[model samples]
Target: MNITDLKIKAAQIRIDLMTMITAAQAGHTGGSLSNTDILTALYYRVMKHNPTNSKDENRDRFIASKGHSVESLWCILADLGYFPKEELTTFSQFGTRLIGHPNNKVSGIEMNTGALGHGLAISVGMALAGKRGGKTYKVYCLMGDGEQTEGSIWEAAMAGAHYKLGNLIGIIDLNGLQISGKTSDVLSSEPLDEKWRAFGWHVIEIDGNDIEQLISTFDMIDHKSDKPTLILAKTTKGKGVSFAENQISWHHIVPTVEQLNLATIELRQQIEALRKEEN
Candidate 1:
């Protein structure tokens, strides 16, 4: 998809996730909205994936380390036909594979994530295995800034560089806020770029919400380098909705009926604007 199309797709995804969350009456609203464009850029434009052949060996892999903000992923997977889009209504319901977190039982999910910092570790293992097996597949892991506080993430960072797993791409959603409050206030993971560089990974920073920037940055990743790459994606929590954007309470709060309606209108307008730009 072109830049305009990607932007439109992202807006629709934001609308879809918000509706799903409101219907389910639960979700990580702020973080999911913040990272919607990042996920859209990957799944729709950058990543090599197939919904019909979910287990294709050579396909690129994506691991959502910040698993709590999985609403955008679930919507994307369903839109891509990994499962029937109708099943989205069952999200977070009893006995549904589409629970609050990413479940490996789901067709496109790589691992059962949500345990905070384990994603990069597992991604390093996948990238290393892919290299050893002589496969060209790449592994991409999306993490939240709040998740950076996990010690395991740093350990995995070291392992990734030591292994020279260039095929491993780790993206941090630097939305600046977490469930409690501002990420800076909760745990200062500042100097994130310098820290990753010191850890021996190539670091790139960009506006995570900008689809064009996301596509360009992702395209620049070197899959055969001796060092892994880390994308410090600065984003805004609750992006795309005026009332919710950057509000900490929305980090995990389900939107009320009125809020959902307003959000839908805002996103739909964005979609329409993007479509016009496409022309």
Candidate 2:
């Protein structure tokens, strides 16, 4: 897909996120919004998966390490026809499969995750499994900047590099803000890019919201041969919603009806503009 088309799809995902969270009345809106573009770039353009057979053995894998942002994954999975979009309304409610965190019970969900720093390790195992089976499928994991504080992340990093699991690609959602405050103030992961490189992984940084850059970066990663790839995607905490943008407090807050309407309008406007550009 072209950059403009990707942008439009991202806007639609953002809109779907807003609408789903609003209807469900509970979710991690901020993180969900922040990571929409990255997820869109993966599910729509980068990852190789068959929605009709979500568990296909040779399909690419995606692990949501920052699983609190499952709403974005849920919305995109629904868009990809993993489940009915109408099921999103049951999110976080009693007896709902669409919980705030991802559950593999849902089709197309590769891992059940919510705890921080677990995804990379799981992805390493998946990549190792693929290699053992002589499969060409790749494994991708998206982790939050805050989640890096967990020591297990670095351990998994070292293991991935040691194993030379070049089929594994880890993308960090560097939105800066976490639930409590700025990630730097909460726990500094300064020199993040250098840290990954020192661990023997190939690292690249990009504006997470830019679909073109994201697509290009994914293509670049696909051509890499030896080391595991890590993309440090700098993003706004509550992207595309004016009121929630960069606000840490919005991390798990459900949008008020007024706020939801405003977000929906902004996303629609963005989508319209992208469509105009295409025309």
TM-score, one value per model: 0.99, 0.97
Write model 2 residue lDDT over 1-279, tens digit each, in one string.
Answer: 778888888888888888888888888989988899999999998889988998899999999999999998998898889999888888888999999899999999988998999999999999989987899999999999999899999999999999888899999999999888999999898899999999999999999988889988998775336789999999998998888999889998888888888888988998888788889
lDDT by residue for model 1 over 113-132, one digit each (tens)?
99999999999999999999
Candidate 1 matches the true fold with a TM-score of: 0.99
lDDT of 2 at 173: 92
Worst 10 residues of 1 by lDDT: 270-279
| Steric clash pairs (candidate 2) | none
Clashing pairs in 1: none
**Candidate 1 deviates by what RMSD?**
0.7
lDDT of 2: 0.90
Question: What local lDDT does model 1 show for residue 130?
Answer: 98
